[model samples]
Target: MSSVSGLVKTEQLYRSQSGWLQRAFAWCGWENGQVMANIRAGRMLTDYGRYHLSRKQFIFAAIAAALVFYMAAYLFYHSALVSIAAAGFGIIAPRFRRRSLLQQRKERLKLQFKEALFSLTSSLAAGRSLENAFLATLDDLKLLYPDPRTELLLEFQIIRFRLENAEPLEYALRNFADRAGIDEITQFTDALAACKRSGGDLLEVMKRTSAIIGEKLEIEQEIAVMIAQKRFEGRIMMAVPFVFLAFLSLAAPDYMAPLYGGIGYLLLTAALLLLLLCFWAMAKMMRIQM
Candidate 1:
């Protein structure tokens, strides 16, 4: 019953957020165009947590996946038709790529937000109100992140823009926290709002929060460094089989020719599926939710 309700909520969200053009494209089995309508309408903020791949990027991923799948299929069964059919798996590759990209964005934003907090604390110490401090922090962030497109810089600019337009600081902060989907930012917003409401020492709170969050981020980075080596080792282990198969095919074609026949065909297919399952399982395991 819970699963059914979850599915219903998902369905409703899909209908509520998507435009007619996006819906039409999705209904026609074009996954790449699902977010194009929103993009064209300049409503990227509304889809902040979800990464939208450009059409070219989506097509490129699909093509790359198709080529890889074709090669793997050919390695197992030297049939051109089978390899072509296997390449159809590429159509779903962009979906997984989008998920991976979203994760990357989140990680970058987390680090950027940490740096922004450091800047914010410094500005708060200089006798600026929270609103003016945010505006002042932009100059510090610009020096640290010279790239105009840096995630944190863009976020600060948005906040600054909202402040200039007389929007409530809490509303702007909450919007940022919602889009970020980061616990650190959410906690900071909640704390700031509470502090402001209670007329507490906002500067001290900012200093404490920034210090704590920085230390936590440092620990996470250390742990990530340790886990990264293991992830690399696992990738090498996964690549060995493909490398071995390719070497065998090149070094002794006659030896592998039997594997393309009769019962060998069934065996190779099972092995291929098993390998894919293992890859999927490893991917899931490697994603350590922080």
Candidate 2:
């Protein structure tokens, strides 16, 4: 009991020191009201862009619905069907923004996954157990990547919060997945759930998964390098026609005068649109997914 008490005291002291160190390293930056306002607007639209809405959020939704109905009626005084359609869009916009944020967060997670795999491997090799490895990797990741690393930290914090509150791990993990906005996080959380239920070697499974991710990333990098020249060529080829036409128009306006006419202008617009569409398709085709 004495030794355990001593260890707890030491941990508390160490944590206090770490907190002081972090504060010492913290930066004070300029604040902007406009930036804050934009952030607040985004938060309002998506309810902090979270997976679930709270009681307050429900109340806010009720208020927004009432406001929308008022606005729709006001607009209806001017135009009926158009106002109704516009109100319908206003109602649906928030939901679309929420889903779009989730998609963006998921893409960020996918980008971060490769780096996370290596961090996990390093943590495991450094004699950390699976849970400790996850915690340590979260700490290491804050500097290594971008906000998706913060998302991992958020998950860890959520888990810690639930444990402190005596909440079930399964419930906490499911909630964490809902907040994570990534399929891999959800899948991994499910795998953890399975391990907890079946009582197996979770660490070994994590290691194997890490190795597979590393191999997959290697192949992806190789493919990216191989296509690098083609992508560059495609971009250059796109610019060439536009540049040539611009130069020709400037040098000999009379010779290129037909391009400004009715049918000629229409054809030119169609050509540019088609060119943009083709480029977009090529870019989409080149994107390799795991």
Give lDDT per model, in order: 0.84, 0.60
Backbone clashes in each candidate structure, one number apiece?
0, 0
* Candidate 2 TM-score, true structure as reference: 0.53
Q: TM-score of every model? A: 0.86, 0.53
Task: State in Å the error of residue 68, model 2.
Answer: 34
Cα deviation of 187, candidate 1, in Å: 0.6
Model 2 residue 116 distance off true place after TM-score fit, in angstroms: 3.9
The numbered model that scores best in TM-score is 1
Per-residue alpha-carbon lDDT of candidate 2 for residues 75-144, written as tens digits (9 for 90 to 100): 2223355446545544333343444455455555555666766787788778886566666766777777
